[model samples]
Target: MLVDGHHLLYRAHFGFPRRVTGSSGEDLTGLFGFVALLRKAHREHCPGQEVFVVFDAEDGAADRAENVPGYKAGRAGADHSPVVHLPAVKQALDAAGVRWLEQPGCEGDDVLATLAKLAVVTGREVLVFSGDRDLYGLLDGQRVRALNTQLPAGRQLVTAADVADRFGVHPVQWPDFRALTGDASDGIPGVAGVGPVTARQLLAGGRRLEDLPETASGRAGTGLARARAQWQEVLAWREALRLNAHVPVPDDLLTGRPTPGLVPAGQLLTEAGLW
Candidate 1:
């Protein structure tokens, strides 16, 4: 199983109901919530599964920003409360013997994609724990599934069939689907008039943006026709949205053994002398 380190941290910091503090009154909500969530997920869904946590590097968005210019611009000005707790979280993870990685200039999504692909090719099933829809592109039936704990219990494990059933497009076309509809989270402004229904219609029949008909009539077709003026930009957005599954990761990272269950958050912090 692969965990999105920063994503989980942010989720824990902001979405966790109550504030948590250390003995010195320092905020430890992010650390506590992250460990608690990971522990619960591991105990319930993937006990004895090998877990690898991947964090986005400081410049992880640089490559995508150069391509799209506006990719994730909003995040720059957003609250960074979760970030201040990252060091403590890392310390706790180390104390608990949970192996985590952060590759320079690579996003956690891409690293997880690379790891998931490597695992699948090696005849191992993979589970990616992240709420980021961009990783949905990595879904390939039972071989690779995403664990979005933000979703309700039974629906957390998202499969390619689930993507196809919910979005009317295959998992492979997720980037294309998001490119047309625009991702507010990533700050990509899609075609002015195109929306989800139109986007879905354009990508119907498992077609990519490049595979769309050049000329057509009707609402969605006409929207596509109007969107042709910015077709190259949309293609670029799709390219930016696609996960790089070929990232260079160390071969020795995995030990090929099941990971032991994670200890509770408070216990880990105490053992690490972080509190």
Candidate 2:
């Protein structure tokens, strides 16, 4: 299983009800919640699976921002307190003998995509733990699926079928789909007047933006017309959303061995003198 470090950390820090402080009164909720969530998921769903955690470097989104100046700019003012817990989280993971990574100039999603693709090439089924919809592009239904822990019991796994059923598009078309729909979470302001239904209609019959009819009528069609008017921007957005599966990663990332069971979060923290 591959874990998206920032995704889980942010969720744990914000979603956790109460604060957790260390002996020195430092906030430890981010660390505690991240470990707790990871432990619970590993124990319940993947007891014998190897776990790899991937984090984003400080300038992880640099390339994307070059293309779209406003990419993820909305998050500039968001709470960043959870990031302070990264060191503790990494320390705890190391103490438990878990392998984690944060490659320079790379986002966790790309790293996860690269590792997931590598694992699949070796015939190992992979589960990516992330709430970010961008990772939905990696779903293959059989070997690759996102572990949607936020979902209910049986519906936790997000397969390619789920993506198709939910978005009326294939996983491969995720970048295209998201480009048209405008991901507010990432500060992407999609073409004016285009919404989900319209985007789906424009992309019907498995057609990409390039394959859409040049001329059409009606509201959605009119939206498509507008999208076509600013064709270059839409195309750029799609390219930005596309995941790079060929990132260079260490060969020793996977040793075909199951990870030993992780020590409990509290116990590990206590041993590390953080709690």
Candidate 3:
């Protein structure tokens, strides 16, 4: 199972209250929340054979910043002073013997994608845990499944069929879908006039951004044409937005067992002073 560590951690950090803390007077809400998530995944999937927690390397934001100055720039100015027990969280994970992977230029999504692909080839059933919708593109071949924590209770299974039902496009076509629609969160400027509706039509029409007709009429056609123009920029930016899975995530980084530790939870709690 591949876990989107950054996505889950960040969500845990923000979703829960800030009142949780460790014995050291450090905030432990995020750590405790993450541990709870880990425990849930362990209990449900029993993927004890091989499990990986992939984190986004800090350096990846620089690449995004270079492409677009506003890429995750808001986080740069956010108030992180209140929740500063992250190092302890890492130590807690280490103490628990959970394997963690990170690559300098790639985000957690890329690492998860690469690992999922490898798992497919190796005859392993892959389950990706993340709240980010972008990872939905990786679902295919019945070998991959994405569990989105953002969905409603008992509706977290985001399958290939779910993608088709929700977005009117195939899972593989998501990247193309986003390319035309652009993602404000990631600072991707999708096709100019194309909204989600038009983007879906273009994708449903079986035309990639570059292959769409230049001038067309009707709501869908006009929006798609504008999207085609915007896609020109998206095509160039897509490379920047895409995750690089080729970067070697050393085996040493993932070296560990999945045994649960008694102190891991309390250590995380104490480190952040949630105890």
- The lDDT for every candidate, in the order shown, is 0.88, 0.89, 0.69
TM-score of 3: 0.85
Compute each candidate's TM-score over C-alphas: 0.97, 0.97, 0.85
Candidate 1 overall lDDT versus native: 0.88
- Full-model lDDT, candidate 2: 0.89
Off by over 4 Å in 1: none
Residues 103-214 of candidate 1: C-alpha lDDT, one tens digit per residue:
9999889999988888888899988999999899999989999999889878999999998888889989998888888899998888888888888888878888878977
- Best-first order by lDDT: 2, 1, 3
Q: Indicate the TM-score of model 1.
A: 0.97
**Backbone collisions counted per model:** 0, 0, 7
Worst 10 residues of 1 by lDDT: 213-222
RMSD of 3: 3.2
2 against 3, candidate with superior lDDT? 2
The numbered model that scores best in lDDT is 2
* Candidate 3 structure quality by residue, lDDT tens digits, 147-221: 876678788777898888888887767777887777776777676777878778766656665666665668777
